[model samples]
Target chain A: MATPLLDKVEDEAAASPYITVTLRIRRFNPEISDEARWEDFSIEIDPKERVLDALHKIKWDVDGSLTFRRSCAHGICGSDAMRINGKNRLACKTLIKDITSFDRKTGATKPITVEAIKGLTVLKDLVVDMEPFFQAYRDVMPFLVTTGNEPTRERLQSAEDRERFDDTTKCILCAACTSSCPVFWNDGQYFGPAAIVNAHRFIFDSRDEAGEQRLEILNDKDGVWRCRTTFNCTDACPRGIEVTKAIQEVKRALITRRF
Target chain B: MSADTTATGSTAAISPVESVSVFDVDHPAPLIEPPRKRTAKTPKATRGNFEMAAWLFMRLSGVVLVVLVIGHLLIQLVLDGGVARIGFAFVAGRWASPWWQTWDLLMLWLAMLHGGNGMRTIINDYAERANTRLWLKGLLYTATVFTILLGTLVIFTFDPNIR
Candidate 1:
């Protein structure tokens, strides 16, 4: 019975198609060393699997010490944003085959490089201190503001008004857009793209009475004025939020005081 | 658990804790100071509408400068005999008219302010040190003011008959 079970497991392993891929990760263990270093791990995985799967495999089977942040693992939680192949992306949404370079003749694959997002303190391997990012978010007062008493039923809004800020509503609080910004990388004081994008979401909302207040906050020296319109935020946003365009809208609102 | 491990509590149900703390709770790790973090010394945002006005001035002055500059360029470099015709007398002839004086005056002020504001933005963006930004902006303002004043004086006091 034991032999049959062992034979069945071997047969399953042989039946599945797996390809060898190398993951080149920038590892930082403060306890071990003060400096970060690059480490490589080779794993057998399916090409269609997400990059998160490969990391999971390496951590579970190869090195239990490997660390990264992930939750939901479906791109909604926005916890696993990292630099993949020099671009900011959610690891859970990136496929191995999509990012890997394969040589057709030799059937060889180039290693996928992974690193922590820039513009934030890296706590450990692929884990960054999110407090700064969240601090910027909280500074913008990202919520509906009204002076009058609460509505007995519900606040009403038009379809067009809701659609006005539809794009920025998709933000998952991921730092992908903010970290990819060159300005933020150089100057941490700049409110960064994510903050401006969040401010835009409310500034254009028809029902939000405090648009002027948010605009004033963003009009500070380090606010929306710092954006150089590099469009890196737009490209880095996994949720397809037009991050730069939203920032422009906020700037316009500041100028005209009209949504 | 072994006797040695029990004595040290290293082999308790929980594994041995790393002896070193990766990060200190008192002093959190930050590659750079947060930009908007407030301290007792931090001043309020008293700079109301200055940046907004500057941004608007850049665009408005840019539009006006295009007309003044291109017209001036066309007259000086392309209208008559191009570069060769631009002599001291030619400048005096243009400055002789109040219309041309206003035009040239507008061009100098707009261009200087426009370019000066651009430089200010660059300093704010690139200069990492506070002292560096202050010194650079100081130099920029001094140079900009000197150029504007000198240009205005020359335009106003041009002597057509001075050989």
Candidate 2:
């Protein structure tokens, strides 16, 4: 009995190779369930495994009907972004051990809480309707517009010119940065950060000829003025884009007419 | 699509490509949305640095307000005595000092403007109807102006020797 107790003590002291953590998941099924509810899952996982892998394990072994969008398990496809521990983040990007939850009583570690990103209508569990997000993106005309002339060759620009808009090009059309914004949470009409980031991509591109038209489009009341520079979008960006800075650049461009 | 094709006739460019311009066959066209409205009355892009100025103002005022508020609370509720020690005489004595008078005045002005601007943001965010936002902001401006004027007058023209 003494030897077994000593072994158990040493195992716990080592933090154990496989640690048990609780996943407090918000569940919703509009057709069946009248209101959303929280469900707890206990799984033993390595600290290095991503939250996406944990979600996969839960779906495969525990609950078959649980629904969420994911493709290209890497961070590139940008399909698995959701609210993790009360902030917008990519499931594939956030590791289980890297994030720790808060305890109300002990003020220490608690269960990992996962919820759907706010501002969009949640269809099933983790799935949110992305139509509104894509609408704002389309409003900015994200594609390069060059009515001047069909380039006999590709539109050529110096490396310096390419670097001007290089940062905004990293956006994978993921709405993580946009949904994390307090302004977006409050007002649906406000063009959120993702759209502005996309606009910045083209507005500063030296090869793009339709900067004036794009600027005019963004000059509406719900445009750049609505951004309060809260920096939540910057924090939530999975691609490491400086979202608030891009918005300020657009604001500066609108003011100075120079991009 | 490339320069190496100069040896071959540029047949791909001449041939009718898939109608991505008109309609994409693989993906359905995104539903057309009515454009966001713009008007000549609103502040145009030519209006330079107004929003930027407001953003800076908020940060500066916030820092100042923090100092003013903490000092005020310490004086009124902690230092000397407590809230029970405060009265009309206390207020009058404080106002008599030019330094205290200036501090109170600054606090009043900054708080009113910050609050009013914040309320304007709230109205912009929540008031669904345009007329509703206009009316709400109008009321907020009126109230802010009224309070600031009254407070400023009080600070400047306080009668320390009232019977």
Candidate 3:
């Protein structure tokens, strides 16, 4: 009787197998050591679980010292962006099954290295200090600036005009697009993509009257001109925004001496 | 006996391999990626492969950029004279060397291409109208190719002592 039960359990386990993937996370503890080192965790997980889920498991069970920042548990928050398997991606959205399926030889998966967004100080395991990212956004004056009095009635906008700036308005203040940019990585002064995209949102707005001021602010060496349009920002944007398009439009606007 | 069974039977009978010609007429195949005949041959519609290449260029260039950029920072800011020493003389001396020239050239070329391709990708993905894409990319590529060629020419043929 026991033998039959064991056989049934084994058969069930074989049919729905759980995969073990190694997560080689970079560990830095100011209290422990001056330098950072890689720490590997072998965890069994369902194929559909995301890397963010794996990190949660590691933090919850495997090791308490592993530190990272995450919110909303979805791609919208953009808090969980990390270098997974050498590419920058949002941890919540990237399913482990998709990554492992690509590996033909070893259905086994390699450790998905998790690190903070580059070009910023890593506060801990996967959280980088985001002050610099936000500073650039602030410098761009992300809020809409209207020269005249506020609209007393509902501000009317044509459908086509509204659609023009629709995509840019989807930005959730997530710095994934900004941090992934190489130009921003090189020069801190560069306004970066997110800031420019925000400025675009206001600049292109029909009601906004501060386009010239914002354009002048963006005209500096560290402003819109620094964007080399690497598309890393686009790839890294979990929001599916066409960031470079907004930057190019700004450039064209500046060149033609238009808004 | 059943209609569904007969339909399944007919499909099975006509194997995909055997009925490719039959399938071609009814199914209107995915726009066959334009054949790559050298310049002599002009295929009907230029599939957006040029744009695709520009897309791939961004990724490849981005990877190379990581190295070029990191090395550049290490040399210019962290090493020797640091930020203060960088000036026209420093640039002139660096450009004097073939190795540095090649490095700078590669950096310039890769950075510009990466950036241009990135902007191209942006134009295709965002600029909805055909004419808009054309004008924007025309300006972008014109500026990019012009800057790249001019920069390359200046780099190799630069005479520092010109009065």
Candidate 4:
């Protein structure tokens, strides 16, 4: 009699409209312990809520200790890139409904594992130490160096000239492209795709005066020469950047100068 | 013989090894590809094998790159004189031995193949138009073959003393 009653209650709960998703987010508390582990979190989520929304809900409503970074809930900020369902993507753009498909009759929920992207030190949970990444960006001298005084008017250029390096300029300084690089993973000194892409932005710019110096910096064995062109950077780029093309342009520049 | 017409095009200038072509094999050479057929699709067998080989190469070369790159770091940075020891003499000394030469040759070949194969994967994935893919790969393969040949030539034809 008791078993039958329990089964009736379970059947009723299964047929309800409200569904709960379980996010097995990896947790790391460096000060507390040397070991890291996954903590299971079940939250009642609306079908339209994103994984980032759920993460915020968990952080604000449920647990204060669950760590991650997000800014400008839009994709432009590029502060919230993480591994969702074994792929690097922006939390803002990834919707829960797209990632999870439910069988209406069976009522089984597909669980997604969320973690930080690989090849960077995890500061806490989804947050990584981005200092080194920015250092590499700065090392490439990502600036427009003009020999003339400040332009009196907006720098006028032909449409084709701007379009030449337009693709490289869309980089949001996101680590998605850099972290996805295998060369960056093995050799930390290698100027990864993001830096090279930025370098290419100026290398192809018609108004820049430092092309020779920049080319010299990129000619080192650890510089542009080190890029293996695996194109993971291109595949992982959320902004749809032509990363390999930029690197090829740098290679061409170096070769042209060499001959 | 058919290469005589195509050789007149800009393709010859793009390749650093100026005289080499697939059709004319009067001398012993590495693999020489037949002149590309504009109307034909890449033969299914070669296409599939090349793609498969490229994919496997990323993983295999990635694993070896890790070891070679790490070993290179240990010797150059972590060892005795560190960055100061790296110079023309250091390279000259290292290349003096067959072991080091072979090591560098393998590194050069593997990295270039790994990189060139990686770029081929990207080209297949992205370059939408057939002509775009063909020309881009033509440029890529030309650059890759040139670098590989130049590197091999430099290694084999080392001149310790110069005027």
Best by lDDT: 1
Across B83-104, the per-residue lDDT of candidate 2 in tens digits comes to: 8899999999899899999999
What digit string (tens of lDDT, one per residue) describes model 3 on residues A63-168?
6667888899887777788877767788899887776533568556755677767766666567777776787788778876765677789778898888888889
Compute each candidate's TM-score over C-alphas: 0.85, 0.67, 0.58, 0.58
The CA lDDT of each predicted structure is: 0.83, 0.78, 0.71, 0.73
Q: For candidate 4, write residues B1-163 as lDDT tens digits.
A: 0111111122211222334333222432332121221123432211112333344467889999888878888888889989888988888888899998887788889899889977875665455567988999999999999999999999999877743
Pitting candidate 1 against candidate 2, the one with the higher TM-score is: 1
Better of 1 and 4 by DockQ: 1
Off by over 4 Å in 2: A1-16, A100-109, B1-118, B126-135, B144-163
Lowest lDDT sum, 10 consecutive residues, model 4 chain A, at A28-37
Q: List runs of model 1 lying over 4 Å from the truth.
A: A1-17, A103-107, B1-42
Q: Which run of 10 residues does model 2 chain B get worst, by summed lDDT?
A: B1-10
Candidate 2 lDDT tens digits, A1-259: 3466887888786865555667777766554433456777666677688888878877766666668899998999999999999888999999988896557887644778888888877777788878778878888899888876586887789999999999999999779998888778766667899999999999999988888888777776667878988999999999999999999998878868742
Q: What is the DockQ of each candidate?
A: 0.15, 0.04, 0.01, 0.01
Candidate 4, pairs of clashing residues:
none
True contacts kept of 1: 0.14
Ranking by TM-score: 1, 2, 3, 4
Candidate 3 — which pairs collide? Answer: none
Tens digit per residue, CA lDDT, model 3, B1-163 = 0011111111121123332333333443232111121122422222222433443466678999899989999999989869889988888899889998998899999999888876765664455455887999999989999999999999989987865
Q: Taking the tens digit of each residue's C-alpha lDDT, what string does model 4 give over A41-106? A: 666776576889878876765666678988898899899989888788888888877788666887
- The regions of model 3 sitting more than 4 angstroms off are A1-14, A101-107, B1-163
Model 3, residue A105: distance off in Å is: 5.3
Error of 3 at B45 (Å): 48
